[model samples]
Target: MHPVLFKIGSFELASYGLMTALGYAMAAFYLLPRLKKINLDRDTFWNLIFIAFMGALIGAKLLFIIVSWPQLGATTAEKIANIFRDFRYGFVFFGGMIVSVFSLIFYMKKKGLAVFKTSDFLITALPLGHALGRIGCFLAGCCYGRPTDMPWGVTFTDPHALVAPELLGVPLHPTQLYEAGGNLVLFFILHKLYNKPHKNGMILLAYISCYAFMRFIIEFFRGDYRGAFIFGLSPSQTISLLTALAAGALWIYLQKKETKNG
Candidate 1:
């Protein structure tokens, strides 16, 4: 896994950035077809996606920087400079997901589009595209797991894995692959659920619940000292807990409504 996909005489295209762009393109393309099923306007859908894309990037970076503030042995100015110097590093997926969803909802509302159903449309793409992006994470070695002695453990031998071999070469849990597989399964579940009659946004709720559960579990396997994990609960895990609870409550409410109406 090469972090820098390639270089052109001082300009390097990072695999992380490349994967992010590819993931968004895939997600947007997938949503285009599903948006029709949800009866959302094509133009509105595109606009909303654009807004969500920017929101996700900014939110993810902001949250990552905030959470990593303790580890920054650098000043605020240096950290700011680093972001400009290397845009490929540091992004928090859950932060981006939450921000993107809310921002897109706001955008769609301003456009007079159906926010709930469009949110559901995004669910179908979220896991699939997230899985693709994790493949990038595996290549880029940003969200790595803890050291391990498992036979199937992986070594960050690839330069794209970012961190040095001294810090990363030990046999480690392939958390990225684990997550990519988890997301793939979630994608299929959402895809099938979409075919059934459930309230709009229920699929998205389901995604949040499922993904949060997995992320919470996976945090235990990560060796790096994310503040969330440092205190025995990673920020992602705490957020996951909240997201799961909210999604569960919403799902139950929707189910009761359908039952009463039926």
Candidate 2:
């Protein structure tokens, strides 16, 4: 509810940004030790992190613009202008994931690093950071849930909340917290899987499968402005379905390959 976390002389700090920074910082802290364990050079590891971060930011914003294009404006000029005007807000997590993965792969290859091995380390840290980002979503009141009469339903009355004007003060499902909890659980699962012996891409596939499923289910409760629905499924849900199928296929392929080699 406290979107503006604090204020100083003519300056205000946002909870969403703070939480996101904290999440990234924590992820970096977790990653450093893992990188050392994997024998990746510290300087190279930091460079990869920087590249992934930039890619994630750009991808998140770009996907948001594409998805929300219909609502941007009536004319092409206005739509283009709107993108720049509203640049500070709006992001899609899946877009960030896809772009970050590509960025990581490209950078690893360019640097002559082991891509899959490095990815195993990175994927394990992703959910922990994502969980904090969801907490930011909750505080900012974006990514809100549908109205619910359940006892645990939450009401957002803050004028600055990202909840739609109509839904302000109305009880909703608190879906942000739900996703945050799910991501935290996913982090633990991936961490454990990392410790145990497994196929190279298993942890990454596991993350995709678990996250896509969680996101697909959570989308059912989301009431915010999700753009473009087809066959009664939101854009995110559609992507989730595709991602889940792809992950399953990849999992099967990896397992078979491992068996053949064994």
Candidate 3:
């Protein structure tokens, strides 16, 4: 809908960037106090977040370039030029998630922190931030939904919007909001889980399982050009399947271990 949130004399503020920043701010606000309560070093926690953020930025852009390479241009020079032009608005969430996890793990180890407990503390904020990011996607008209006749279908009329040019003005499913809503719900559920005394890695496992399932279902309604498909499933969906399975197995193992110790 409203892609440009505001404009100054020559400079324009994008709704997507604003919303994403708000999400980060909100997550930080929620996290800082919790870090103190949990006895985690505030400096270490903030450092980990910064590292994850940088890693996510790089990974998301790298994956986007890799997946969209062929479509960038027909010639080498054209492709190189297109890279600079297209750098503004493309990212894959899974790529960011993958890289951020590895980065956080390495950082935690380097700092001599308890990895699982630190991850559990940090991950509770993820869905909350992710929900806002999805709303940003909605406003920016990226990650749009498939065509639909439903009354809730949204039409993107802004010429500056990122929705595919051909799909402009067409009624679409509003998949961004769908995921946003799902993530909000997930945030609350994870918050409750975090408050309760649970296994060390339960929160992380829960997030993975819940988000994987949500992403898998939501992929069906996604209309945007999301990378390649393998065996009739989109890249995200394939990753979701594997992530869900792995998380479920780990969750079970953790539960058994806790029970044995108890």
Tell me the spans in candidate 2 whose CA falls farther than 4 Å from its real position.
none
Cα lDDT tens digits for candidate 1, 1-262: 5777789999988887888788888878877766657677777777777887888888898888888887754688877777676767888887787788788877778867666677787778888888889888888887888888888788877744765557656888888889989999999999899989977778788888899999999988876656855456889998988898898888888788789999
Residue-by-residue lDDT tens digits, candidate 2, 160-238: 8889999998999999999999999999999999999977888888899999999999999999877867888988899
Cα shift from native, residue 196, model 3 (Å): 0.6
Predicted candidate 3 versus true structure: per-residue lDDT over 158-197, tens digit per residue: 9999999999999999999999999999999999999999
TM-score versus the correct structure, for each prediction: 0.91, 0.94, 0.94
Is candidate 1 or 3 superior in TM-score?
3
After superposition on all CA atoms, how large is the RMSD of candidate 1?
2.1
What would you estimate as the lDDT of candidate 2? 0.88
Q: Using lDDT as the measure, name the better of candidate 1 and candidate 2.
A: 2
Model 2: residue 83 alpha-carbon error in angstroms: 3.0
Instruction: Give lDDT per model, in order.
Output: 0.80, 0.88, 0.88
